[model samples]
Target chain A: MLSIQVIADVWDRHLITMRTIEHLHMFSIALILSIIIGVSVGVFIYMKPKTANPVLNFLNIVETIPDLALIVLLLPILKLGAGPTIAACVLYSILPIARNTYTGLKSVDEQYTYVAQAIGLSPREALMKVRIPMSLPLIAGGIRIALVFCMGVVTLGGLVAAGGLGTVLQNGIQLYQKDAILVAGLWTGLLAVLLDGFAGMIEKKLHERYGTW
Target chain B: MQTERLFDRIESIQFKGITKKYGEGFAVKELDLEIIGGELLILIGPSGSGKTTTLRMINRMIEQDEGSVTINGIDTKDADPVRLRRNIGYVIQNIGLFPHMTIRENIGLVPKIEKQNKKDIEERVKTLLDFVSLPPEMFMNRYPKQLSGGQQQRVGLARAMAMDPPLFLMDEPFGALDPILRKQLQKEFLKIKNEINRTIVFVTHDIEEALVLGDRIAIMDQGELVQVGPPEELIFNPANELVADIVDNQRKFKHMDTLKVKDLMSPFEDKYVLEAKMEACDAVDEMTDRDLETAFVFEGDELLGQVEIVDLMKCRDRGEKLSELAKPIKTFQPMDSVAFALSEMKNSGEYLAIVMNSKHPVGILVSDEVLLKLI
Candidate 1:
């Protein structure tokens, strides 16, 4: 008969691998969607600031909902798994990226815009050619922060038996399998750390290119 | 675009009771003026004097609270801002080349947006680059970041000229350069303007630049145009103390025209025949045939001083040989301005200053000639 510890070790190894992959999977989708939706919404608000306040206030209200309850409520409709998990992750990611985008684009120097116009560029031409290039670094930084935070939420998604690292953690909890829980926790931490480091390097490179904070 | 052919005849611009207010007070108040075409007009004043505000009103960049600006007999209030702006070229201190675009792309931008063919746009860009002396092969593909400030300003100039607009409004385009470079560029631009004659409305606070470039200058104070006139007229007779102070500094540059050697040359000086030591005996008679009153003797190519006929006659009486005189001829340096030469002439109390190249006297100018030309 296999020792319980031996079974626990096998569960621990499987949980580690699954959790790492799940964290990457959930965060990646959320981050990519946030970039597209966030940049668009940010640019829209930047173009018309008068209408942006109410929309930002609405997003602020949505952010007030508790993360776990929000996930559970989404579970019934999305039927648990990667879908509901991704939706929750994406919802959490937009606030920072969208806000950053709006602020960054809006803050491009007016003199730069005036120069572009005096040189005969239309408004859209000036924004795309001058303002956006200058503002991208700040927007990218916000996305980096959003991605790291979303990874943490994704591991929590594993609790719904979504086959993420949270599955091993939950199963280990049930049987008092200390090793299994430890491995699952270790992998989740490593995953968040590696992703964050990657994003940080990219953000730094972008900031250097655009000379922005 | 040549000045005479600009719309067959010059069109006069009229601003009718133009008023622009930020809040309670007016930024530009009930101002009325007329601007004639083919003239280089400079608008100058202190900060917040509405000089820029007035220029912007010409193209309607800022909406006037109450008033109408008419250009070429058309009411600017009813015209489309974009269309009006396109017809007029505008340049600012920043030289705003699009950061992401190549020089060619920035210069070619308006034509591209207007749906011109690729070939035509490329041709226009190349032509403009050449006209600005920034060759296309060297600068066309380079980004703005790669260019120096002066080069970028030239690119800005090229971009403004791309549309072949009849009117150009420049808001301190060279205001950001260091003074020396700014002066050099201003002088260089005069040569360029001689070739391309478009109606130019320039804005600047520097009085020297205004005096150098302006055919007519309009001085503004608190958004009001206090006076406008030709540079010479403005300097001699200012509208008030403000105008007088602005012109007082420009008087220095005017001295450049008065300091020529030809202006100081005299007609009545004893003529000296300039001759080489190797000149044959027949050449001595040749000098006398030319009605020489004196002879300037030389050794090989070196200048020896004046040998008067009286001195030679006295030498003949004493049974002595003819020789070169040891006196130095007063001379004016070629590069010295007429004013400096005149001052030097006055200081020395000399009737003439010899115009020279190094130690050689090229010509001579009298005090009376220099004084006549000073006016």
Candidate 2:
């Protein structure tokens, strides 16, 4: 067995490298896909609100389930590991973004819409130029929330043999290795804080650009 | 300011039996009206009277369930909506500027969308800024948030005009502002409308605004046209009692054009000018030298009556208070016709009004100032 010091020596070297890269890969994939799915779902809900209500309700139900249990439940169908873990995180991220988009798009002032129409802008043109542009700040805010939530969930997702800091954390916990656990948990926490802060800056920039409070 | 020639292309609007129905009741029904080219048409009505619905129908923003709206000569239905909108300018009360864009970008949007050259768009944006009284160099780079409400409105007007649309649809664009700002913007808008000569469909609830701005007024009730005519005709001869009440409230303000100092100027009588504490003694001496008989005792242009030699001696003898001694100066606005001046003189019991711009005097409205020269 490798001495604890040797594992410590490699901890910053091999383990951190693998954890950070894999963490980034899984986080990015989950975030991008979730955004795509969430926005599409949001747009659909916007266009067909009656249809959206039921669909959104179902997603809200899915979000209510505990993340670890949801992953374990997914393991039965997808057979464990990164696939199920990433899938569960993506599911968790959907509610905030999708709901946000729907609400934002719906809440744009009716007068602006009428004015756009009076200017002879077509339905599509009004939606793209007036409605969508006006809703961007709120939509972006929702996306930021969803992204931070996903980042946190994905770090925890490493519990399921996913190749991220969660893997290091799980091993360190099982093996009673204090240094190993400290490094993974601490880095994951730091990355979450960093990502959250970055998303916040982007949100502020968007609000300033769009003249939204 | 390019004054669109008085006879430019005769861009009239005609609505033939237009009707809009929502479920059981009609919003507008069988509405027939002809809007002349280069005329501002103000549409006034209580809320839910379908005035807005009618405004929207012209641009097909709200589809009329029946009849046709023709611009120039082309039926609105046949015109492609996008292309149609490109040829029409729209302004709303809230001044809905695109939040994400700078003023320049907002004004140049339709041009940019049509793939106009960048240089042309820039030039047009700059020219439009100057036309709207906003300096391009300062406002062009600023976003809507940086602008005040009135500034945003002017930008909105510039954007609407950028495409040089022959028709303008304004839905109470100044209604949200405070009364002072609304009046100022209304005056500015009149100047702009004169410059552009765009056929306008202006909607408002305030009768004073309607009479002040409209060449022809269309009053609507429950989606029906109650009356349509020049403001004078509407006021003098209303189609019904409802129309009469609206015109009644606006009558006093409308009489502004009828009141003039020339109609009521009493005269520059009294051998000597007023000698008041406010007036420098040397200034009084100068008036005496000029063969001006009566010095009108004025407390800052409130023409205190003629300071006759008798009143001056009374001041010297009894020491009359300046406020009591100063005569009331009758005033007349440039727009006020002679009739109003005579009435104001009679009612105020003062031959002259302190003609003022706001609170400060501009000129004396003596009785002789009447164009008739009766004074």
Candidate 3:
């Protein structure tokens, strides 16, 4: 019978604690970087609305490229390390964040913008004060989606010799260590659920604070 | 009273041959108009008739392709558009109070943008809420979505009046409201306007609203001003078939021509009389003695229109003499149509009309008595 003791034994031997820390590190760095790049690009596209469809289409095409293929493609340029893995994860995260941000900003009531202008707010001021604040729930939603995407992609970083819980699962499978694989799989899922729940809490708080979606 | 002093500083807005075109079509053709300070000029027309376009030009929301729009003799183009807009208040039909901001913040926005003192902004916000008849304590903390349409519109108006700008531009400000609410807001707006004395350019497609609120009405058609005059002039002497047609709809239902002064006239009474040179207290005593509602002032053989006891009371309140309260007479022949007399009475805001027969006054036509006869 597969037991908890056996799972603990596998976790201790495989340095599961270090792998979990590496997984969280990769996910968080990629998420932060993705948010900065994605949000900025989204805002830029919103300002130059004519560019939105083209930019989003390009990002959509980038998203269609398999995650493994993207990691492989980046390997030659970035080499086998955390760098390429984080880059791949960031690339994977961009589509949801940028698309949601663009859609959110674009969908704000046109009357609010008109009133902002009529009240003499400069375009920049209006965007910052009215548009951005109103679009918060959606922007936060995008960030949450990107965080979830990062969690999954960070696990896949193991394929490129990048350190994370995926390495444990891969090694256990090769060695026929069922307990090791099960333990790693269980922790990875737990981490994903935990991070997702945290993101959900943030989105909820933002919706409550702004009182809007 | 403080608003009166602020009002006197505003100069008239002049549109000198201003023209705006969108591609091959003109939204507003070469237009020349002078909107007097502190007056409510209503621009009215059918859809796509350039009433909105003309109003937008005043604040340079839609730039004029030719000529210039000058506020207080200063060309709008010369002033920074943003700065110029900051100084002018604007309201729209949508009541665009920012949904994210509380009602207080929405109303205080202009003052905040203008960098007024924080305490002063709070005080002004409270004052404006009261002015619009919204209690600050009840509404200040609430978001716009929580308010009803009428309340949101009141907040919109309060927001526009936040900085107390001498000029206000409204583009169908109350067009979205139900008819009952529209009428109530219109009456309230008239009261507010009387107190503030701001130069207002109001846009509306409803002819009835135009007549009810405009100090002067400007009718537009095909991007051109068809006629501009007081509501009475527009009703009695329309510039063309279109203006006549607009008035005719209301005139037909009113049965205006069929009414005559003789049908509504009341017999002249001796008790309702006072000499032109009578003392103020004596006039009041005479009215009190007979329990008369009005007293006609006489100078020798000539008859002047009657002054209501209400006017005497108002004179007392203002510490003015009885002679100051003797309004000039509006005399109509007994054969004159009731519509004509009614129009005169509406224009003058007097309830009593003198019905004269060639040489002397024969009777009085009280609006209430006339209305009763109609029923």
User: Candidate 1 chain B: minimum summed lDDT over ten consecutive residues — where?
Assistant: B1-10
Interface RMSD of each: 3.4, 2.3, 2.1
* TM-score list, all predictions: 0.71, 0.76, 0.75
Clashing pairs for model 3 are none
Candidate 2 chain B minimal-lDDT segment of 10 residues? B366-375
TM-score of chain A, predicted model 3, versus the true chain A, to 2 decimals: 0.94
DockQ for each candidate? 0.17, 0.39, 0.32
- Report iRMS (Å) of candidate 3: 2.1
How do the candidates rank by DockQ, highest first?
2, 3, 1
User: How well is each residue in B1-375 modelled by candidate 1, as lDDT tens digits?
Assistant: 111222333387888898899888778878888889888899998888888999988877778888788888888887766666777888877547766568988888777777778899999999987776565776799877776566677788888888788888898989887553465467557767777887888999988788778889998888788999887777778999888877665344356565455543433222344554423333333433443434455565565554533234333324332333324545666666666666666676654456667866666554432133334
Q: Candidate 2 on B47-94: residue-level lDDT in tens? A: 989898999887777788899998878898987776777777888876
Docking class of 2: acceptable
Q: Write the per-residue lDDT of candidate 3 for residues B29-136, one digit (tens) a residue.
A: 998999988789999888878999898887677888998888878888887767677777899986488888899899887678667788999999999988887667
Q: Candidate 2 on A124-190: residue-level lDDT in tens?
A: 7778888877777788888888877777778777677777888878788888877777777777888
Which lDDT value does model 3 have at A74? 96
Query: What is the clash count for each candidate, in the order shown?
Result: 16, 36, 0
